[model samples]
Target: MPKSNVKKMLFILSKATIENVYAAFIMANGARMEGIEAEIFFTFFGLEAIQKKKLEHLHVATVGNPAMHMPTMLGGLPGMEALATKMMKKEMEKLDMPPIGEFLEILSDSGCKLWACKLAVEMFHLEEKDLIDDLDGILTIGDFYSRATEDNTQMLFV
Candidate 1:
């Protein structure tokens, strides 16, 4: 496709939780597969989704999240989130979806850009080394705004 025809998409991830991360990546990869330019900007708690240590441990919230359908009381039970995470992973496997680690590699290989927030890193006491090595690097909100404000860029805050 020509530069004049490229479609740009920006996904803003604000939650550190599991379901949100999955949704963001699913959308980003879908856009890339459709020949649309995609960039996922991780800010605030969303940084946790990219952290090497916590990324794999991400679990969908069982409660307090309106979509999960579980009672709020059940969500507080010990090990419930872990159990939910396992269930989710199992379902993903059945669907042939790659694990989180492999999924990140897929995004990178597919030309989907990944970036973390500079302010979030400082506030969370995290260094660049803490995130996946494939990252494009930390981007300032100002930087994101300028790019996202460009012509034909569609921004979605997940």
Candidate 2:
């Protein structure tokens, strides 16, 4: 491709939960690997993925999610969310996958732009101190769109 034809991507992550955040990380990593100029905009629930206070509290679903089936009785146990999340992290470690925090860090280091939505941040009462240090800045929807409108830039809402 010509220099001007380089691919670009704008990832809008609207869900801050574990599964969704992981998906966003994977997509950003993949886009970077393909030489795309990638930007990740965290909004609404998605902001949780990048928030220092809530990042570790993310959980994996072992019950209601059809893709995963924990032992029926185990599913209803009191500490199920914590247990499932721990188990999932262990599994990921066994596969040599990076933890979510480190994954985000790697992407940020590799030139992926990370932004938090200003409106969502205010709505959630989140200050800049609440967000992970790697965020480039906070932006409005219009600011995000202005950057996303570049040629060959793909926008994804997760």
Candidate 3:
């Protein structure tokens, strides 16, 4: 690990939850504002957070999510997640937050690096071409671990 003046903030996103992705981006941006080198790694369902086709359709877990205070059984109900997603979007809009894609674009422009997981891409049969254009790169778990373990690199999973 190389000694540096700035810290590396690594956020590993393994879910597709709207809140998770939003929080990661928000934090990454915040870290950059403080002069940190921040990056977000999208893996598993989290890949949906960066996929071009799934960005706007992202949703919060409506049921079986302790945060939502709903029972697990309710998660099986159709359209609940969708309903929650709509409500969340409306609330965010009221607060003047940009849509997911725009948020990503702003983050990218702000120098927040974005990466996708290699294994997850193959497991989910995803094509790199379908992801947003500004991603830093697709990384294997081993490579990610090595980089994340560098001195002053803090790994956060959401």
* Greater-TM-score candidate between 1 and 3: 1
Q: How close is candidate 1 to the true structure, as a TM-score?
A: 0.91
TM-score of each: 0.91, 0.87, 0.87
Give the per-residue lDDT digits (tens) of candidate 1, residues 36-59: 889999999899878899888887
The C-alpha lDDT values of all candidates are 0.86, 0.86, 0.86
Off by over 4 Å in 2: 1-6, 70-77
True lDDT of residue 70, candidate 2: 58
Pairs of residues clashing in candidate 1 = none
Residues 1-158 of candidate 2 have per-residue lDDT tens digits of 54546588899999866788888888889888888888999999889889998887888766666666557567768888788788888987898878878888999999999999999999999999999999999999899999966677778999
Ranking by TM-score: 1, 3, 2
lDDT preference between candidates 1 and 2, better one:
1
Error at 88, model 1, angstroms? 1.1
